[model samples]
Every structure is written in C-alpha cells, then in structure tokens.
Target: MDADATARLLCVGDIDMDLIVRVPAPPSRDGKVDGRRIAQTPGGMAANVAVAARRLGTRTRLLGAVGDDALGREALAALTSEGLDLSHVATRHGEATFFCVILVDDEGEKSLVKVMSPAFLPRADEIMAAAFAGVAHVHLTVARADPGLAVAAMARAAGATLSLDLEAADLPADLPQGGGALADLLASVDLLFVSDRSRAAVEPVLGPLTSEGRAVITTRGRQGAMLERSGTRTQIPGHRVPVTDTSGAGDAFAGAFLSAMLDGADDATALCRANAAAALSTRAYGAQAGAPTAAEMAAFLDVDGVRDA
Candidate 1:
C-alpha cells in the first residue's frame, strides 16, 4: 500500500473493558436465568475504530484516557497488541477504568450498560500542530466536550478531514443546555456516523445532514447502511454472516470506510469495503477478534459475485 494514499488516522475518544454475556431473554422481575456464555474483551467506540483501521493496514494513533487500575492496564495492553500508536493515551489516577456490561439476546440484539470513571484531564495543551503532519483523517467520539473540541480544531487547522461519531448519549453534562452546540458541531464535520438509535436525536437538530459536500452515514445493523452525500442517497447492501455478537459492528464499519476514503476509493467502493468488514466482524464473539485484515476483506469480497463498485 502506498503510504501517501492511505491516511494516518488519529482517533480521539473512549476506551473500556466490555463484559459480554449471552442470555436467552431478559430475566423476569426478581428472577434469575443462566447465561449461555460470557466473554471479557476490549471495547469502546473510538478504540475499536482505531484497531479496525490498523487491522486493515492503516497507520492509526489512539488517544484516550484510562485510569491507573487493572482494567486500564488490560485495555492498554490489548490496544498495544494491535500495533496502534498509544503515545497519546493518558493515564489518570484516583479513578478506576471505565467498563460496560453488554447483554446479547437470542436474536443478536445488544443492550449496553456503561459505567464512566472520573473524567481525565484535558490534553489540549499536549496536542501539537506537528502531530497532524501527514495525517489525512481525524476521527472523534464526542463522549466529552473539551478534548473533542480541541482535537476538531487542530484537525481542521492541519487540513485533515474531520469525522465524528455522535455519541450523543455520552456528551458531557456541562455542555450548554440546548441542542445548539450539537448543531454547530454537525455543520463542520466532513463525515458523520450516527446509529439508527441516534438518528432521531441528531436529525431534529441538524435536519437531513446530506448536502452538496457533506456526508452523513447511518448504520442500520442487519439492514445494511445508507450513505447520504451530494443531495443523493446510496444503499450499501449488507452481507449475511453468522451473528455472534453485534457489539462493535458500527465502529468497524466507520473505521474501514474512512480508511478506504483516505486511500482514494469512490463512495461506492468505500461503502462496500466498510459493509464487508462490518459483516465479517459479527463472525466472532468479541469486537477486536472479528476485525478483518486487508487480505481477509479481499477474500470475503471475492466470493461469489461480489465486486467493488
């Protein structure tokens, strides 16, 4: 791969340990049910996306905060094993690492319960202009306001395309009491990732985000995904795969699609690549385990009549 063609990504967001349990159904009130299986893995929107990009042969850097605890060490080790640049990952004291409990039902539906640790200090002063050199894209999960805004500003000033995962539910509590802040953020983002669940909250503020130049990509789980751009909408068909857990499928799709775009792929081709990755990610129990390599992606896409658009 040509180094210049593909972007060196900078992913700024959250990291957590995910405890995934497979259950037959929600337990009856005051009742107990046995879980089919349990798996503990690294999971967080921003961290998952960075790992996905790296697995697909993109140079990626992950910047986030974690506590100085056992879970934090484990999460850091997991990310380091994936070969992501973690020089920017901050370690804070007096707090435990964040984590989530994910329950997956028989139908592959997931319900997440997250616990956030104390906020880490802002790293805006550490963000140097030189850090963006040769970086083609900056991806953010706006779980907190300060860091996200700082990174967005730096990415823009460095001439890199800016992307955001609208983690609306996790936005900082201190943000101005209105949707105005969100609307302003949406106006400048080049690519936006919104889950089907978040589309309602986002659309009411920004209206339909698709326009002549900006693009808003929505992930609809098994229904595939839609790319809205240039006043047009393109349906990227979903691939059928044996579902294990749907924990990080959307994050995988976002990372793969952005990496493809940085490599100069057309919208259709990028979406195809992303969809293939997301589909393949469901074949395993954990988010990172199912992330496909470039070779795996090619093989998956080569089967049957599948072809790049």
Candidate 2:
C-alpha cells in the first residue's frame, strides 16, 4: 500500500466555518474581554482530516454537506485550494451552514461552541454506494451513526479499509449505553481514534478493540499518543513544540497516521510520523493553516530526530 495519484481515500462528515478567537483566559458567562485576534477558517472533523491527508500528498475526497450560503462557499473554496475532491459534497438550500466558534486561551487550550445546520444530517438519497468504488480507505467523522453504517457497508463491498474518529459522534447522548447499534458501527472499523477525555466513557462499550484485531490509537494531547494493536501496546511520546493553538492537532494526527499506514509504514514508524505531524500543526493559530506538506513533514521529522521511527 502506497499513496499515488490513484490512492483514493474518502472522509465523510461535517464541513464548517470555524471562527477562531484568541483570548487571555477562558471567559465567564455573560462576561466579555477584548480578544487578541479573531479569524474565520474552514474546519470540521472530516474536513480537517481531509485537508491534513491532502497536505501529506494523499488523494483525498470529502463527502459531507454545507449550506448554499457565503460561509459554505468560502469553505468550499478553501477545500478546493487544498485539492480535495468535493464531487459528493452537497449544498443544502434554505439552511445555514454549520459554524463553530473556537476560543483559544493563553495556553493554547480551546473551548468550542458549534451551531449545526439541517444540512448536517445528510439525506438518504444523497448517499450512493457507487461513491465507494475504487476507494482504498474510508474515514468517518461520525456525527450520525446511520450514515457511517451506510458508508461502511459500501466500503466493505468495495474492499476498502474503514476508519473512524469518535469525537464527532454525539456519544452517550445518542447511543444506548450497553453497546447498541452505535457500538456495532464502531466495531466494524479497521482504525479508531479516540481522545483521552472520552476514553473512560467509551472504553466500556468498545472494550479492547486492538485485542480483536483492530487498531486503536488514543490521542493524549501534549503527552502524545498511544497505539494498541495485535495484543501489543506502545506509547509514542509527544514532541515539545511552541504551542500556538491545539485546535486541529488531533485531526492532523489521525490523517497522518492513516496516510502513513497506507504507505506501508510499520506501527512504530507510523505513530512517530503522526506525532511529528500533530506537534508541527500546533505552530499556527487555525487548524488547517499550520498543516505541513509531505516534504515539509519529512524535513520536520529529520530536524526533530524522528526521521522514521
């Protein structure tokens, strides 16, 4: 497995307008303070991962929705410049696009508030099994479980590897506690990315997925990441970098890790590459702005003494 012009990878989920504001500290309710800066950028779990993978020279595509509004147009333009295939993306009429307000504090920690549009719940007619044809890998930033199941079924028929990011899913609120339909959908994936904060809540339902022959990578912010697979687990220490905003670091890690694995990198090598990419992503303010290209990533790895594993 290697990335080339024909390496078809698809990311399915949200695409939003991210309004990022930098503040000295977390704001209190009904209290306001002058912000250092504010900027609008394209963001969303699937969109960010698609951009990250594109930065690594993978042939990536996005399958999601946005409103037929200016914000949606802006996001489309940004993704287009990044070279992601948007043929399957939908434009919903009479609806506002999804938007998120991200507040970054002095420590680069963030708090986000999101507004989702009706378009976020894609219509059944919009999903087509043929879309998965020839795809080598399919990643879902699952906000809705049903669509993910639909896509996974298609991916399975196409013989593509399936991957998932759990943060996008509305978890405990939407799924049954004792491992229901949602758990079944998650179990079908080849790779799973979970944040440390959500680990405890999720572990009970998913159990040790790696022990079942699936790869699970846990993202632990500044502490780096850990990979568990084939009954073995390894901790990949995070790199120390000048942190600006940690908004898209996890997305960077997921995308880079998937691309590395597709490129035939071994477990340790892939985890190291992912950590390097994620640490480098924190050098800038917005999620997509700081992502490095393949060559840039190679140089970063060399400088950081993580050339390959």
Candidate 3:
C-alpha cells in the first residue's frame, strides 16, 4: 500500500525541551568539571520521529501534551514549525513541561537524565475517536500501557496500520520486567522498533510474534538495523559517516523506515534508506537539527531507493 499526498500518520508520546551539555567525559565519582552548555532544543522520542517523517514529506500528526509555560511554548512552537498537525496535543495549564538533560561526550555518545511527569501523558479516556479520522497509520513511542491500548484499539477500529518504537531506555521503571507488559504491548503492533539493548528483556516475548506473522526490529548504532520475521533474521548494513551527536539517529531510523513504508518500499529498501538517514542525521547537534530531507537522502544514497544487497 503506497501512501500518497493525502496519507496521514499519527505519532503519540511525550514532548520535551532538551538541555544538551558537552562534557569531555562523564564526571567520575563525584568529580566536578566544567562543560559547555548547548542551547535548549525541543525533542522527544515521539516528537522527533514525527519531525523525521514530516521531513520526508509525509503528512504527519502528533498527539501528546506540554505545559502552558515558556519552555512548553517553545517546544510546541518547534513542532508547529515542522507543519505537523498538533490538534490533539494538549496544554496543561499549571503543570511543568517534561524535560531531559543530555550529556554528550567527545565521541557523540550520550547519557541522559529525563524529568518526566505522569501528568504530562495523555489519558485514554480523554482521547476522542474522531481525532483519528483519516489517519492511515499510527506510531506510538513509549507511554503508559492503558493509553497504548486505547490507541491500539482505535487504530484497529480505523483499519490503520500500527507500529511502535519501544526503546529500552524509554521504558518506565516498573514496566521493563517480566514478559508481561512488553508482551501485552507487542501484541498491539505488527512492527516494533526495539533496541539491541532491549533484546535480553525483549527476546522471551518475541517467540510468539514470529509465529503470529509479526516482525521485530533492532537498531544498532553505526551498524544499521536487523529485521526478524517468521523466525528469519535479515541484517542490513549501516552507512558509515563522520559523527557529531548520535542523539536522535535511532529516531531518525524509525521515522525514515516508516516513511519508506508509506512510500511502498520493501523492508530491505526501507532499512537502507533508514540507515542513510540516520547516518546523515549525526552530522550536526541536536536530534532533529541534522535530519535529512527526502532530497538530501536521495542525493546521499545516489539512488532513490535501492533494494537489499
């Protein structure tokens, strides 16, 4: 199924203001060191994916929340600038917006500390079914189970294809254990973008997926991604390039893969495009700043869409 101009995609998750600081290396054992502070940038798993897909010329929509405060306004303004449909994004009157402190080392590897509030997540009951009208696809970032279930049910009802980016780092403290929560959510999507870091926790539940005709994917930094379907695995090589900040490369991969799928590209072709997009995204700082446009992506690969090697 190819997505045309009228095709719509919905992204659901948290939106945040990121404070990135460049440090020589992680401070050791209470060691104090000075670092250069980068300017605040608006990004979050769901929001970043939305921006990436939107950059590739998809008509995208974002469903999440932010505060009415200045920082929240700044973040919302960023999404608005991307031309994403923010009609379902809520504005909490008195609460503070979620934010993250990302520390990047010389090698562009990062460690982040996020300050999130359950209050910032959208509730399932508050969502109107009418909000999803005309949406052809739904991609969910890590969120509370109930809301994920709600969205999944609606997507099924609307006959929309569903996918999820279940990054291990984003899993809440309580939900990462056992095969229960992950398995429950896994049942909702036909495609999952899991991290290699999550394989240990994610593997046990994956057995059922392949048997059910679902696919599970794992993204490896600078090593491209691997896709598993029907118990068969395909390793797609990554594009190597000069690295700057690796912050949003994976999100770029997820977004680009979804965009390619919308364009009717096969899995291997989509992953090659996604790898190229992720590599290009590391050319600059911040997650969304370095994301390449469709033209940029096409030029880099020197081909519009090449099939697997």
Candidate 4:
C-alpha cells in the first residue's frame, strides 16, 4: 500500500451545524463575559473527521441523518464543497437539524452544548449496509444512540477494516459502562481512538484486548498519544503550537491517522502524522477551518523533533 494509493473511507455518525464562539473567559456566578466573535460552520464528530480525511487526499463518504431544514442544507453544502459523497445522507421533514454551541475560552479549552434532531440516528442496519459497500475503511464516531457497534460489525462482515472513536459523553446507566460493551465492540474494529479521560472511565470494564488485528490508541491532550497493540505500547509526544481552538483536534487526529494507515504508513508514522494534523488544527478558531493540507502536514513533519516519539 503506497502512500498515494486511492482509499475509500466511509464515515458514519452525527451530522450537524455548529455555532462556534470565542469568549474572553468563562463567566462565573453572577458574572458577565463578552464573546469575541461567532462563526457558524458545518460540524459533527464524524463529519469533521470525513473532511479531514478528504483534505488528506482520501476519497470519503458520509452516512448520517439530518433535518430538511436550513441548517441541514448548509451542512450538506459544506460537505459537497469538500467533495464528500453524501448520496446516503437522509433528510426528514418536520425535524430541526442537529446543532452544537461551542464556546472557546482564552486558554483554548472548549465547552460544548449539543442539541440533536429527533430525525437523526438512522436505522443502523440500513445505513451500515449501504455505506460499507466497497469501502476500504470504516470510521464511526459513537453517536448518542450507540450506533457504532452495529456499523462496526457490518464493516467487519464486509472485510473492510473498522475504526471507532468514542465521542459521546452520555450513556444509559443500564448499558455496559465504559469499555465493557466497548471491548466487545473492539473485537470487530481494527483501530480504536479514545480520549485519556475516557480510558479511565472505561478501564474497569475493559478485558484483555486480543490484538489479533487491532490497535488501541488513547490521546492525551498536549501530552501526545499512546498506542497499544498486542503487548506492545508506544507513546508519541505532542507538538508545541500556539493554540487558538482545541475543538476538533481529536477528530482531526483520528482522520489523519486512519488516512495514514490506509496509505500503508506504520503505527509510529501514522501517529506522527496524526499529531501534526491535530497540532495544525489548533492554530485557527474553528474545527475544520484550521485543518492543514497534505503538503502542509508533510512540511511540518520535515521540521526536526515534530514527530520524534
């Protein structure tokens, strides 16, 4: 698998409109804070990752649900502008499009409030069967409804490699907490991307992962990332960049990493490329706006010490 080989990537999960605002600082009780600026953009964990993959020179397709409203139209337009295949995106009437309010503080940390449309969360079996057709890789951003498991299973059944990112914070108490159900899902995924915070929450339920055909990656913001497969563990250090927004850094990393892997890059090379992509994403104010092109990422990699694990 040469780095230039064409790879078809199918992304499944949330699709939404984002309202990103930069504020001086978070307001305290009875305190007043002024926002610096506001920008509306097409975003959603899965959608952002798809855009990142496309920017990195991978053919990408998106499968998700949205309302037949103005926001949904805008999101579709954005994905189209990026050359993402949206033929499978379903739109329903009488439902508002999913959206999120992202507030970035002066320190570059972010807080998000997400509002989902009732029409979202398509039938997992239908969406998975259609999206997995002829795809080389499948990446799922865990939705509030936990659609990734079914999608992953389908991808595996089709002989396509599967990747998963756990992005949702809310889960039903009765459901397998953390990595219990997550570990079971891992049996089908070739790669797993999760936050370090999430690792702690999930560690208790995680069983001994049989890395027969799988790699597990946990990202520690600023500290870089860790990769575990089989019994081997490797830590890749983070890059230093003037941070503007950390909103979509993780999503960018996941996309870049998958793209690199599809290009036949080894685990270390993939982590390095992913780290550079994530670092570049923080140099701007919005999620997708700051994602660098392949040339830019390559140039950044040329700088010594940027990728030294």
Candidate 5:
C-alpha cells in the first residue's frame, strides 16, 4: 500500500483522563511535599498512539469506551479535536471515566496510579467489527477485555495486518498467565511492541523469538529498542534529549513505529524514527502535548542520521 493510502488504521483500546503532577521527589511515609504543578490531559495507551499517529501524518480511527462523566466528555473532545474519528467511542452511563494519577519526580521518572470502572471495557465484538471496516491495519492496546484476540481474528478475516502493544497488568489466575494467550495472539500479529519489563513476564511464555508470523519488539527506555525475529535480534539506539516527563514515551514510539511501517519504511528505519519520536516526547510535560508532528519527527530523524532501513 502507498504511504498516503495507508490511512484508516484502527486503534482499539482505552481512553482516560491523565493527571500529571510534577514534584521534587516522592514523599516518604508520614511526610508531605507540595507538587510543583498538576496538568490534566487526554491519555490512555490507545488514545496516545492514535493522536501521535495522526500528528505524524497518518489518518486514524479509535474504538473504545469511556464514561458519561465530564472527564469522559473531555477525553472524547480532546481526541476529536485532534482529528481522530470517534464514531465508535461508546459512552457508558453511571460509570466514572478511567483516570490516572501520574507522579513525576525531578529526574523525570514516573509512578502511576490508575482507577478504572468496569464500564470502560469495550465489548469485543462491537469494537472488533467497527475497527475492521475499511481499515488497513488494526492496532490493539491493553484493556481488561480479551478484545486483542478478537481484533486479531477480525483483521485476519479482513486481510489487514495486526499490531499490538503489550502492557504489564495484573491478570486473573483463570486467564492465561505470563502472556501465553498474548503469545498465541502474537502468532497472528504482524508486529508486537512491548516494554523491557514485559519481557521478563512474557519471554518465558513466548520462548525463543520466531519471525514466521510477526516481528517482536521490546523498548528499552534510554537504551532504545530491540527487534527479534527469526532468531536475529537488531538493536536501535535511542536519541538523547533533555527529560521533562516520561509518561507517554512508549505510546509515542508505538505510534511513530506503526506510521513508519505503514509508510513502507524498513524495521530499522522505522525504529529509528520511533526512538526519535519517543525521546522528543519526554522533552515536554503532558502526554499528547509532547508528541511531535510529522515535520518535527522528520527533522529529528535526519539529525540522528536515520534513513530508510
């Protein structure tokens, strides 16, 4: 598919309100410290990625659920303001919107506390079917439901490529442990993006890397990212930038990477652009606020000696 024609990718995941507080340090027990500032923004893995993709010059659509509260309305408005198609975003009554309180220390490290209502979980069938329509690729982010598997199956049925963002979360014992089901889902995905912490939990379940069906990638913070496929592992170094907030760096990477892949850039080049984008995202406060536009990412990539891989 042509780069411009690669528009219409579908993003299925959560949309939430992010409350980012910058403080000198984490408070100790029985101690109190006033935060420097607090900023509320639109967040959630899927929403961040979709906004980043759109800012990077890709047409995108989002399918998810939010509450009917003010926060949910603000979240939906925020995404719509960014030009994402929100036709599939459901608003559930009597549920508070999912929200996260992010604490960022002086060095830019962050700790997150999230509160979610069960109503935020999207119905697997509805989101999957809505996202598959006229979409070239389907990207799934972490959610309480097993919608990832449903979207993967639907993408296959529609002959579209599948991508996933693997996140760390507490799973019920009855569900597949250590990402076994995630590994099986990866078998049908064209690309899988995971964090280094996720590797410790998922590697044992996935075993050795194989490229027969997908590319497995792990993001290593400042160290950059690694791609393992068909027994060959390639490392892409990250760009060094002044740190301000690290909240949405991973989502930025995933968004830029998917945009590059859809643009027909090779894995290495795509990762380079992604790394640049992610690094840039930390140079400012707030998640979507820090995401670079296509021009900004291109300039950074050029300065970093990144070319088509």
Candidate 6:
C-alpha cells in the first residue's frame, strides 16, 4: 500500500449485462421494426470504464454489486476474464441482475432501455480504507447518496483524485440535481464527465460545481469532447472511424481519460488520447469488445496524430 507503488484506477458504480440490437433505424413509439440481436455483453458505466482502463494498461478495481442470477453470473464471468480486481464486489443472493437493452441503428446511434431489478446497492459501510489502498483515482457513477459520499470522503482521504459521472437516474429525486447539496458533494471531486443528454442536469449550478479546482468534461460523440475549467473551455476534436455501436463510447472516453491522467498526461493530451480511444471503441458492437489496449491506443494516436492535424 505504499503511495509510490499505487498506480491503480478505481471505478465505483453499477455493473450489468447489455443486449445490443441493430435496427434499420430506431422505431417510433408503437411502430414495429425488425432488428437482429448483434451481441450480449457486459456493460454498465462503471464496468465499462473499468474494462476500458484495464485494457489501456492500468491496474483497475471495480466496486459494485451483482445479483446471483444467471445474468449476474454471466456479467461476473465477463468481468473476471477482463482481469479487474473484483474482490470487493458484492453478491446479492436471490436478486435478479439489472439488464440494459440497447437499440443501435444502422447509423450507430443508440437508444437504451434499462430493466431494473431489486438488486442491492453496495452500502457505504461496505467500502473500506483497504479498498482505497494503492488506489490513485476513483471514477464514480453517482449512486445512493450515502455510498457516494462515503466513496468521496474515503477517496479524498486516500489522496486520490475523484471523478463523477452523472447518469440519468441522478437527475432528480437523486444526487446530481441536489442543488446546494450537489455543489457540496462535487466540491471534493476533481473531474466530472457529462454526456450531452445529461448536460442540462448540472447546467443550473455549473458555476458552483466548477468554482473550486474541479474540471468538467462533456462528451459530444463524433465531435469529440469539451473540457471546461475555470470558466474557460477547450474543444478537443474526435477521430473518425466506422462506428458499429455508440453505446459505451462516452464511458470509454472516461476510462482512457483517467488512464492518461494517471500517466501524468496533461489535460489536452489526455483529452486527445481519450477521444481517440472512444472512437476506436465504436469499431465493434459491444462497449468493451473494441476497447483499445495501450499499444493499440499509441498506434492509433500516431496514425490519427492526436486530433485532426
């Protein structure tokens, strides 16, 4: 647990399986459209980030829970094969695992539907100082307030940087949109990742969110991403590739971005690398399927030249 020996990234949030379907185009309400199930893979923002970071040559740890159901076993099997430290993952016996159904169009745009189970949330008490041993950064998808707060406090205490990604579930009646409470929560975090769809969730209180030493990254798909810091914004262009699915592109970016940061890469350089990693991940059907390794990422950047040069 020596400080200098710690080079791991941590992800705390959900883990579930995804069923991907490729449609001619997304169907309108009540409009039947024929499609094919392209793949069923392990997903969930936290899990995706962990896999992506791990592939990019960082030791990663995943702190989440899964049900004891078949889907949970499958998801655990996939994750176990990916080589992440899941020693802290909880097993909710008799509970059903969460399921995500992704509908990707021929154009690669995707809409997702989540089937939630009564799966348990890993309580804050379950998180321990040992879990932060040798942990450098914690990428978190905001879950229940107590657990999220525990993670933030412990991560800060470990002198590890904190990153928060707000999912749709945290928009209201939840953590991200907690107004003053949200600002206080984010005060301890170092980075924030936002998708275009969740942009408005923090727009109203963005000022306070970034007032301290916090930075915000908004993933804009093909256009790449934007980094906001101290009221100024830097635009990072994306690499263009034949996209197969856009489901986990943003999560990939989050993972690679953290990987770069852990390597001591600066904001701009990290953004470029992360943008490229995200573009490469879309070359396959599942989120983790096409994630690039460290060498692959390096080769991609060499060819792509770290932005549209």
Strongest candidate by TM-score = 2
Runs in model 3 lying further than 4 Å from the true structure: 1-7, 172-178, 204-211, 303-309
Residues 151-251, model 5: lDDT tens digits: 77888887889887866563444456444665667677788888889767656655644467678899999999998877778899877788999999999
Query: How well does candidate 2 score on lDDT at residue 284?
Result: 89
Model 4: runs farther than 4 Å from truth? 1-7, 28-32, 143-146, 173-183, 205-213, 304-309
Candidate 5 regions off by >4 Å? 1-7, 28-32, 143-145, 170-180, 209-211, 305-308
Global lDDT of each candidate: 0.80, 0.83, 0.80, 0.80, 0.81, 0.82
TM per model?
Answer: 0.90, 0.93, 0.91, 0.89, 0.90, 0.91
Could you say which candidate leads in lDDT? 2
Clashing pairs in 1: none
Local lDDT at 111 for model 3: 80
Clashing pairs in 3: none
Question: Which pairs clash inside model 2?
Answer: none
All predictions: root-mean-square deviation over Cα?
Answer: 3.1, 2.6, 3.2, 3.4, 3.1, 3.0
Reference-based lDDT, residue 170, model 3? 56
Candidate 5 lowest-lDDT run of ten: 170-179
Model 2 TM-score? Answer: 0.93
Cα-based lDDT at residue 220, candidate 4 = 90
Q: Which scores greater on lDDT, model 5 or model 6?
A: 6
Instruction: Provide the lowest-lDDT 10-residue window in model 3.
Output: 202-211
Off by over 4 Å in 1: 1-7, 28-32, 119-130, 171-178
